[model samples]
Target: MSISADSIKAFYKDGFIMIEMNKGVEIRFPVSQNRRLAVGTPEQLNNIEISPFGLHWPELDEDLSFKGLAAGDFGQHSGCPTRNRRPRAVAGR
Candidate 1:
């Protein structure tokens, strides 16, 4: 798939970041779901730069890719539960 982001917006109040794709597709996720971003202040979250490949927060040292976000991935290898992992049901009571 072609990876291109037209624009990116961060909502501090809502605690989510939104990425608008070139094809008019928008992807968003909670800031709390990311390792580096979860603890970032509004000021830190606000200091962001958007690239064709991903979103970058220099102050917070955070980066998120359009493809990753679109695929329901916030981050990995950070000890946080991935969005794609489903909880297993208990077999017996």
Candidate 2:
């Protein structure tokens, strides 16, 4: 299923992005979690486009799905080692 955002804002000072969903739920994630977003200036980060399927940062060339955000999946560089890293094989006993 696809989820869409009602509005979005970049709180640069707070170091996170906030999305207000149509269901009155708010989803937030730190900018540091995203590689492109972490490097964006306040102006660039604040410039957001909320589409039916997701959020877009044209200046940063980044797009994140609303469904994914709600699920705590903050793009490829989310700093969650388990999410981004490949599983290592265990040595034979």
Candidate 3:
């Protein structure tokens, strides 16, 4: 599924990044869940630029994709605990 965010806002008090999609769906996630935005200050988070593909915070140098957010991804890369993947089984177990 493809999603494009029409607007985004930083809710500093709640520590959430709120995104409004083109289809009128809103998605939100804790700032701490995202690696780059995890340590950003209120001022840094407030300074955001919204694009058709994603959101960019030039001050904090953080970018989040709309589709990824819609899919429950908050910028955690491979090996990150938030991925929620189970360990593979051994062949000879």
Candidate 4:
């Protein structure tokens, strides 16, 4: 099944990005996980465009798919490197 985002928000102060899914699911991850997001300022990070399938940050020129995010694949160019491993998804509250 394909999951999509209803809305996305970047919490710069908390250093996390949160996505509210169409089915009332919320996924949150650290900003440090994505290279572009890690370095983005509050203004830039907050500029999110949500599509049916994913989220986009035009100011940072970054995109993250809902499927990928659900699978814990932040990005290929993540700020923090993992050793051939995928982090577990954080369930919504």
Q: Residue 66 error for model 4, in Å? A: 0.2
Note the clash tally of each candidate: 0, 0, 0, 0
Give lDDT tens digits, candidate 4, residues 1-93. Answer: 444433444334568887665456778888888888888998888788877778889989999887888888888456346646787889993
Candidate 1 lDDT, tens digit per residue, 1-93?
444344445445578776655556667778877888888888888787877777788998877776787778787435655546888898894
Q: Top model by TM-score, which number?
A: 2
Q: Decide which is better by TM-score, 3 or 4.
A: 4
Per-residue lDDT over 74-93 for candidate 2, one digit per residue giving the tens place of the 0 to 100 score: 88674555675677899994
RMSD of each: 6.6, 4.4, 4.9, 10.1
Angstrom error at residue 74, model 4: 0.7
Off by over 4 Å in 4: 1-13, 77-93
Question: What is the clash tally of candidate 1?
Answer: 0
RMSD of 2: 4.4
How far off is residue 17 in model 3, in Å?
Answer: 0.6
Single out the weakest 10-residue window by summed lDDT for candidate 4: 3-12
Comparing 2 with 4 on lDDT, the higher-scoring candidate is 2
The candidate with the higher TM-score, 2 or 3, is 2
Task: Supply the global lDDT for candidate 3.
Answer: 0.71
Candidate lDDT (C-alpha), each: 0.70, 0.76, 0.71, 0.74
- In the predicted model 1, the residue pairs found to clash are none
Q: Which portions of model 3 miss their true places by more than 4 Å?
A: 1-13, 77-93
Instruction: Please list all clashing residue pairs in model 4, or write none if there are none.
Output: none
